[model samples]
Target: MPDATASILLLGATGQVGHELRCTLAPLGAVHTPGRAAVDLRVPDAIRRAVDEIGPDLIVNAAAYTDVDGAEDAPRRAAAINAEAPRVLAEAAQTTGAWLVHYSTDYVFDGTKRAPYTEDDAPNPINVYSRTKRDGEAAIQAVGGRHVILRTSWMYSRRRSNFVRTMLRLADDTDRLTVVDDQLGVPTWAGWLAEATTTICNSLLGAEGASKAGCYHLAGTGQTSWYGFARAVFAQFGRTDVAVEPVSSDAYDTAAPRPAYTVLDSSRARAAFDLPATTWTAQLDRFCERIGTEKGTPKAPFASV
Candidate 1:
């Protein structure tokens, strides 16, 4: 499957998933991660120039404005980075003969469906952030090039400022917590996504790479509500001191209305690339184990909250 030594341009190298990707994508090719000064995603001209200058065979875009509630206040900035930037990259990829690998969110769906959302489902973004991400997906598809759009849900890392970290911090500071129980989604480990992405990049260099270009639901297998996830996090981390109480989402007055359900069906991706599937709980357990070893937290079996 060695077509040629690929020159890869990886965007958003500092982000959670991006950081994991930086490690996993290293073996595939020469990865060049440009800083904001080198390539400003806010400016389309800067993005185009970066693509033109690097002339990469593969571009993995992990940069995104992920502040869901803050997006309501700064829609323009979100649109610039999440919406227009992808369109420019897709066009540049088409011109440079590079395969663009982009990450989107399962929030594109309204979350009303009881089952996992498939690639064919129409996007019904209910918030500004999700709208911008959904728009980005549409723009990339419209550009019509060798690209793969992977949509994941509830992605978290041991190092990032995510739910797992938040829960740990809360347990350290307080003994009681109120978490939303209505909303449902699958929590995906960042390392798993990075591994999947590397596999996809290798496939891209293979003969079947072009055929796999399109939208695919790439995410965790099992699903759980935010409340359940919080419980599991505290349980696995041996934070028995914290008493997490489940509450309705209506208890909080958030700017964005989170979808009630957003589980993603990653069956297509697994079948297409021969990827293995793992449950969110298993991923979380692995993550907790790492946290215990690295962060000096106590690790235990899955305990009920």
Candidate 2:
């Protein structure tokens, strides 16, 4: 639906991925990122009013309630943001004849399949957070508008509550870290995900992408367990000062039940968009290089750590 002078309405500008998206989407069109006060998703009326007012050719929704364990305690809030909100957005997109791009989670799968999960794999969400995401995907598809729902896993950034940042914090605060090795996924950098989304946005402006509209897996190329990912992070930084230990998922008493494996196969998105195949470890190298160049750390400066 995007033309040369396309108008883009991006939700969740404050988020890790959304923050990167604000700059990445600028070259494509005029990107409008309204704060929560203006586009409060919980208030459906506010969402419709914002969508109607903006009238964007492309609506990229990077926003969603992402607190996995927290969702166990507050399912209603999570559903409001993850399920009902996306449904309303899809309705608005259908009304305005705009293309909607929404993000989903790998947790939608029960993680029973040890192999990489494909797009066709049926979702059997085991937790409240994952269930809401699955509901959101269903609502969008039910609308039958031009949309692409990307299911990704293990998203991280320098400024977020993700595994990467958590490991960095642990590396600074302590030398001994015990991470779960049973749960497997691809640790995708938020910036890279933003760039990939930008590429998809460009392609979606054409005929080919329209035909490929559907749910697709778009995470990192390779996969590893949480313990392996953490070890890789430390290894990238050459953190000999720290020691990492691998344990089972049962080691931690989490509010939500974690799937044993949720690694997504991005082959569908790759074949559709002609995206390059890059591994998670290679991306980790790039991430570490970026952080090494930056001045400060999460708590104690990296220079000292």
Candidate 3:
């Protein structure tokens, strides 16, 4: 376990996972979350400066350029944040002797495998976003620092503008929802990720935990497609009146092509950290409960178009 007095430097404090990390890491140690004014990930020098200044015992990076389609138009911008920025952080961690905790995505895979992707699976990124992320992972490994890379998928939170929130908003404003069912992956809750990160951090900071430093899949247990996830979200809100149609990826025009399947096998993470597995439906239920309690009432059910 990490020392109770350890100082932690957390990047991307305003992001979905970052927002939750700030709260979850508090009990573990002092977490310094630098805003964009202090550390702009787009600027490599800023990241170096923040790392040097904080000189933390642990550095947890939760930031990334997550716009899959937007990345197709701006590959350089994506590389700067997803690849170059992480290289800088890893180097800093090496020099400062601080452990680095980084987050990755399941997009790194081509998703052709019939089963879930494991940590050892060779990455064959098909899109710019995934390629950049894959590069970032390689950079960290090449830096040879005490780091742990967590690969997750379909991340969502109540605060962020993610699929869950988008579906809720659409159900409130529209009637029919046509979602893509071809793509498949786990829908990981940011809250659960943050919590798991803390556990992983504690283990890494412990006496025998250093040897556990490597890549692992940290995501929700069960799997589902975009269409299935949308249906679950609507069901959570009692919005069965809405018609949810399943469509193939070819039905929609996009700048980038999504993977056909990217379900991650988190057995390594579970065995390593003794983390419990949770189904996507269970996680979604918890998320909905939180949203409902916060909002005080569910919006009207969506109707067929």
TM-score of 3: 0.95
Per-model lDDT: 0.89, 0.87, 0.88
lDDT of 3 by residue, 1-305 (tens): 44578889999988999998998998778999989898988887898888888889899999999999999999999999999999999999999999999999999999899799999899999999999999999999999879999999999986656897788777777799899999999998888889899999988878877889999999878799999998887777777778999999999999998899999999999999999988878877777665443223455322221
Please give, for residues 236-274, the per-residue lDDT of candidate 2 as tens digits. 656667899889877899999989989899998998988
Candidate 3, which segments miss by more than 4 Å at Cα? 1-3, 294-305
- Please report how far candidate 1 places residue 289 from its true position, in Å: 3.3
lDDT of 1 at 267: 97
For residues 1-305, could you state the per-residue lDDT of candidate 1 as single tens digits?
A: 35337899999998888988888888877889998889899999999999999999999999999999999999999999999999999999999999999999999999889988999889999999999999999999999999999999898886557888788777778999999999999998898888888888899878878898999998878899999999988777667788999999999999999999999999999999988898898787676665444323654222221
lDDT winner, 1 or 2: 1
Point out where model 2 deviates above 4 Å. 1-4, 292-305
| 77: Cα error in model 3, Å | 0.7
Tell how far residue 297 is off in model 3, in angstroms: 6.2
